[model samples]
Target: MTEPSTMLAIDPAAPGGPEVLVPVERPVPTPEPGEVLVRVRAAGVNRPDVLQRMGLYPMPPNAPTIMGLEIAGEIVAVGQGVARPEVGDKVCALLAGGGYAQYAAVPAGQCLPIPQGLSFVEAASLPETYFTVWSNLFERAFATEGDTVLVHGGTSGIGVTAILLAKAFGLRVIVTCGSDEKCAAARALGADVAINYNAGDFAELAREANGGRGVDVVLDMVGGDYVPKNIALLADEGRHVSIAFQRGPRADLDLSQVMRKRLILSGSMLRPRTVAYKSALADSLVRDVWPLFAQGKLRAIIDSTFPLADAAEAHRRMEAGEHVGKIVLEVP
Candidate 1:
């Protein structure tokens, strides 16, 4: 391996806008116990990364933190006691933080072999969204075959992935998107019903489509005004899992509605979870979902890729709500 004193990365000194993100050279990290030093081939751009950059989601009391949550790379060096993945293994990891760099240290257990027939760019897009969906929607929400699921952001990377995976598991999917074209895109991606949230009431549409039974589950990212509507749209014993709040988090809840429906309200953030816990989520994905991906039955939805130096542009696109799938940064 070539020795380099520093790595090129996107850094945010003060968070306000996309312009705040600037390229910088930072010291390369070394792997600690149970970790592997990865030569990053690509890193995924996610909403959380943007939030972290703006100081909304601070970096665990650590300043000057590198921004990223998932990466695809080759294991260039392994720390002591790590045996399964040796040097030169191509993998993707669910990072706690610090994925936007030429090299980043990741826990060995959080790494998974890249799915067969996937490029580094595609692999980089899977870890964060897939892990969050599996853990929250399937595991926590008890979403099962024959159930009906309402995904709030149909054109999004998470929404598309949820629709596909839910369909793969024999579940019915309804998604909400901003435009008719985007709605059509969601339908083409396996959404049973694509409602234009700008023009239609998704709660009513989803309910009508389900024959007034209401959806069995809702995977929500828009949290403000949608909260009550979410409660109204759920079937008895239904589950609502929120992974983000694009509309803001403060909302009034009606306890009576929650009681009447017997719904489960839950939220999960993948980054703050323990390595061991996240490793288990990764294991389940490898065991259950990897086969489908390998068979070409399920794959990632990539919206765009930008050079690492153009991260600010990537964040701008994301904030504009113009992107439909995952945005990525090419390391080389």
Candidate 2:
């Protein structure tokens, strides 16, 4: 079947609030070399997408201005040298941009087969969070079996994925949520302990919950004041991986403590990375993470889903911070 000349997309014209995300007509993109044209079934909404909508996150050079980072769809066309994932193959892809549209041109190597028995929305939720946690928690922090990890935002997409990965890998996990309900939700999802961050000192609570040994790793998305507390919670030679700074970016650190504890502080931003680098991450996910999804050992925690035209409402839901997991947009 011939593709349409245009498709609906939520690309804001200017930096502003959720009200700016209005559906607009955009030309259907053709597959570039080493790429595939996917008829997007769904796209995942992330914190970065919120920031992008507000104009706080800058688009990488030559990237599509349309807003989205991950999408799940079916391959409709393939560019040169793309021997695998022929027409009609179902895939979920990580994109630097352009995922919010009905159609997306994705790098071939950045595409992963949708796991058996998973919907497009579930598959759509995997790329961004899975790639992030796998890269930082396991690859960068080298979190191995028997380690204890403290994950902030227990009910969030990243936090939930961390809990599941920790459980599947034999690690003890403690998570923090804003409310008792989310705490229970986290525990039900296999977290060893879930603390309500608003009730008391999360560092103390997490430590006590972990039997007072302190955590071997801390996966922090909240920066600023939490930085010192996070450092204090780390055991000797502990690793701290920062993925986002919702509170604020700048943090005060104690160099002496860092030196004495032999702690490592590191973080990474995914959007600005090269296609070759992200492709490598996709390969790693296929080897180490995709099987867990295929076997039903891991599942994406979907909080809510909206139609493609309701993209504005989806952003509002995310910004409200009440949702328990990923918010997805189903393409019409």
Best by lDDT: 2
Query: Please, what is the whole-model Cα lDDT of each candidate in the order they appear?
Result: 0.87, 0.92
Each prediction's TM-score versus the true structure: 0.97, 0.98
lDDT at position 327, candidate 2: 95
Candidate 1, residues 1-332, lDDT tens digits: the string is: 67587988776677878887778899988888898989999999988888887778956543238888899999988888899678999999988788888988898889999999999999999898899888888998999999999998888778878987998899999999999999999998988999998887888878887888889998999999998898888889999888999998977888888898788999887777777998888889889998998787898899999989889899998988878889999997
Q: Write the per-residue lDDT of candidate 2 for residues 1-332, one digit (tens) a residue.
A: 99999999988889998888889999999998999999999999999999999989888998999999999999999998899889999999999999999999999999999988899999999899988999999998999999999999988889989999989999999999999999999999999999999999999988888778879999999999999999999999999999999999999999888999999999988888889999999999899888887777898899999998899999999889888889999998
| Clashes within 3 Å, all models in order | 0, 0
Error of 1 at 157 (Å): 1.7
The per-residue C-alpha lDDT of model 2 at residue 73 equals 95
What local lDDT does model 1 show for residue 239? Answer: 95
